[model samples]
Target: MSSPQPPPHSSPTQGAPPQLEQLFHSYGAKIYGLALRCGLAPKDAEDGVQEVFLKVQRRLGTFRGEAALSTWLYQVALNTLRDHRRRVVRQTRATEMSTLSPQAADPHFVAPGQSPVEQASVEERRQIVRLALDRLPHKFREVLILRELQGLSYRDVARILQIRQGTVESRIYRARERMAKELKKLGVEG
Candidate 1:
């Protein structure tokens, strides 16, 4: 089978463009998840998603499919979030680091349909995990999030991160090792 051709640049006289909508349908969740994992709060994550697609739409017409669509989408999402992060410094909670507001402690995406007790337990555990993840060094945290959370292949991550595959493998190894230490410090049993 042939590779995907880039989208046409001309203004179609027809209805809404199909390619952007189709791209959103296919990659939207992954983009959102990536942004959230990158440390954007929920609202910022939402805005980042919009910004990512805007960038994606602007250039996807020329995206020659040199890489997989997912790789391109991941690259766009990562760059957009990194750029946004540099410009926006959100205020932290007024409470001490030792204290977490109940609502603030909930994970960005909570699993539904669990019993109330199960939900609370899960939320607490998620909060602990999130705390540990946040405490990790940025490079290690990123590698862990992409490899463990996103489940992207080492090669795919290397392409998106523009690093060597050997570097991806070594970094992922170091990331996991550090994450385990972080979790242990958070009182999680690993």
Candidate 2:
């Protein structure tokens, strides 16, 4: 008798084509980094990574090989981030009227004893980088994050963002220039 086969809609098995674990092992860190660059908090980034992987799992069979696998993953991650941002915006708007008035204290101030000096320095630098990133227009920051931080090729970024490769290259250049200027102001050269 022939062995039974799992249904087509079931998750791919270890012996199946296009091993999902292997794909996750190779691209997971890049996906998490991209999620972080998308302005997600650490926990939110983790959630976004999980969400992207779930998406990859569901859609892997339909991948037609027109784009690199990494490019497809990037697109999945970016869409996840966009969804997260929209949810956050909606929640913020819903809570806006009931929130208390803002205090005059610096929002970025970290309380003493909260972290060690070295940790604090790292956190401060992260804050500075995030501030610089926030200053960038969305298009520039997206390209910079995908190209520089995630280490994706310009071609992959263009494919993920649905823009021309030249546009990705130019936007990354301008984004880096703007980030450099902002970093200089923050005493974080380079």
Candidate 3:
């Protein structure tokens, strides 16, 4: 699902108390997008978003503003989604969590000016890249999503993943290499 339209007024600053509904309206799409990129099936990603908001509701009082609200939100989402994946995997021992649902394709990933055949080709490649991303290890996927897809800086990614900046850099580099390998296996050029 696409993100909800942002609230009409200015969002609360980082230090302010998180208005749960407002935050959901403001950032739910972002969180959902993150879940999708992290390889959660679309249905699971939706459920994961709900779970993240529920955790936020319970812990909102504890937010100390030590980090940006967005950062804390991402941390909560990643942890919640990770736990959710583990539970699902344990429940269904043979299920593959990395399979991309057909519905999971983001229409926005398609560029505007391409011809129909070109668009189809581009989307095919996008799906292949997403599949490669899904196949990545969680450590690699997390860093790549945060640094590349979410466009966070190395320091911010380090903060979100609670790793050293150097580690984030290294993970991103390795993730890219792994992704290239995966795409090549799928017949996509670098």
Candidate 4:
């Protein structure tokens, strides 16, 4: 018998092996939208997307092709988002628990706009929206983001979040009620 041939190293681009560029092209917008809904700043969301793709690149060979490509991508994106959110929460808690204060103000606080009044109003609205979102429990907030912001179908949200469709619907309803209450407090009835 001829000498045993070693198994070929899987080439990165052979026959739909989930190339990094293709993955980004297909899922970039969804991942970014998810990151935004995760309450990350725009820059942080961008970085999260990049970091997610890096993980995808590293883990591509391990994908078994059992699920749809989109499903796998969403799973990766969700994991990355959770990791980033955990890091941010830890950092925030640490800062809140710290006594040391820097002399200089944080540059991230600067508002962008024309007049001070306009900027103030914009900032106020943003604050109100954020407060409303914060008032929601995690399950509710997630359903609202997936349904309203991300425009996911209830079925899709259920699938992605591993919840029953009825649960998704109920959580979304509760989230809307909580958001309305918060908005009413902010003098924005609707």
Candidate 5:
């Protein structure tokens, strides 16, 4: 079972409204992980953070506590990613497919606390794991990352994903097994 999260500023007597900055400060890492594993490239994930908050800023008053703030934020993030992906597809059609890559200017995905050499190794490993993760279908990938990487509970994941807990469990199991197989195919058996 998961530990209970205290409700955030549930009532007027509970305190002030949850600030956007505070939300970012508290949930930014989890949101970023969610975006990355949801199939956004690292660059798009960063941009998606801004877009997610913008939508939140616009629609916040409507939230009204029907669900946890985290659950609400996850929904917003997913929507924002979908919108961004759509825009990309449209632009690709308009521009007739430029071959230029955005990756050269994209910043590092993982933060490092060690020497450059160590950081490089860490980055390499992360890229490997991300590649394996990318090979999975989105449904399995989303469930696996939400539950495993972000440490959200089954109940939380089910609510955020709008799916049953049993589906989450089965998808997670398949995702893990598939990821392991992908890693092994790259000569990275563990």
Candidate 6:
């Protein structure tokens, strides 16, 4: 499918929501990935994507085109996920920790070659990092996930999070320091 073009002026040309299928085709995977990286279970991630698109369907006409569509969609997705988190009781860390598996490993961290023992060791480190990340405050975690894990530019993260670029950078720096402290508590050195 061809990409959905932004309207020349703010809002859709005729106050119409873009076709749901077109929007989903263009962004579903990215939204799902963001949900998963934010610590949602696979099923929850899928559901979150649906919820985000539902919002888009309902409110796309309200979008002013001041930001890129992806940015606006991300803002909606984060708000949806935040609301969901507040509505649902959280799982204990032990239960949540067990949910991480090899399939969920970040591709960016994969090594081309490793002995079985080394692979197991690497996986252990990843689990530790996940635990450390989960311990971070919401604001810090959001920046790290967007900037470091999702590999978004500082500018894009500021737009999505609705914060200044300097705020994003400072939060990331603080997040790294806190992550280091958490890892140290778990006996992993930086």
Top model number, lDDT: 3
Task: List the candidate numbers ranked by lDDT, top first.
Answer: 3, 6, 1, 2, 4, 5
Steric clash pairs (candidate 4): none
Candidate 1 RMSD to the correct structure: 9.0
Candidate 4 worst ten-residue window by lDDT: 98-107
RMSD (CA, Å), each prediction: 9.0, 8.6, 8.2, 8.7, 11.1, 8.9
Residue 8 deviation, candidate 5, in Å? Answer: 31
Off by over 4 Å in 4: 1-18, 58-67, 96-119, 185-190
TM-score per candidate, in order?
0.73, 0.66, 0.76, 0.69, 0.65, 0.78
Candidate 4 structure quality by residue, lDDT tens digits, 7-31 = 6658654533447768888889889
Model 1 accuracy (lDDT, Cα) = 0.77
Ordered by TM-score, highest first, the candidates read 6, 3, 1, 4, 2, 5
Pairs in steric clash, model 5? none
Task: Write candidate 6's Cα lDDT for 1-190 as tens digits.
Answer: 8999876645544633457778888888888888877776676677778788888888988999999998998899888876654433244343554443223455346577877778778888877887787788889888888888789999999999999999888889998999899989989988
Supply the TM-score for candidate 5. 0.65
- Candidate 2 C-alpha error for residue 50, in Å: 2.1
- Candidate 5 — number of clashing residue pairs? 0
> Once superposed on the true structure, which residue ranges of model 1 sit more than 4 Å away at CA?
1-16, 85-118
Give the Cα lDDT of each candidate.
Answer: 0.77, 0.74, 0.81, 0.73, 0.73, 0.78
Worst 10 residues of 5 by lDDT: 98-107
Candidate 3, residues 43-83: lDDT per residue as tens digits?
A: 88888898999998888888899999998988898899889
Task: Compute the lDDT of residue 109 as modeled in candidate 2.
Answer: 64
In model 3, the runs with Cα more than 4 Å from the true position are 1-18, 86-99, 108-110
lDDT, candidate 5, 1-190, per-residue tens: 9999898865657752469878888878777766665656666678777788878888888998988988998878876866775565477679987322223223455454677888677666666776676677777777877778778899988888898999888888888898899988876867
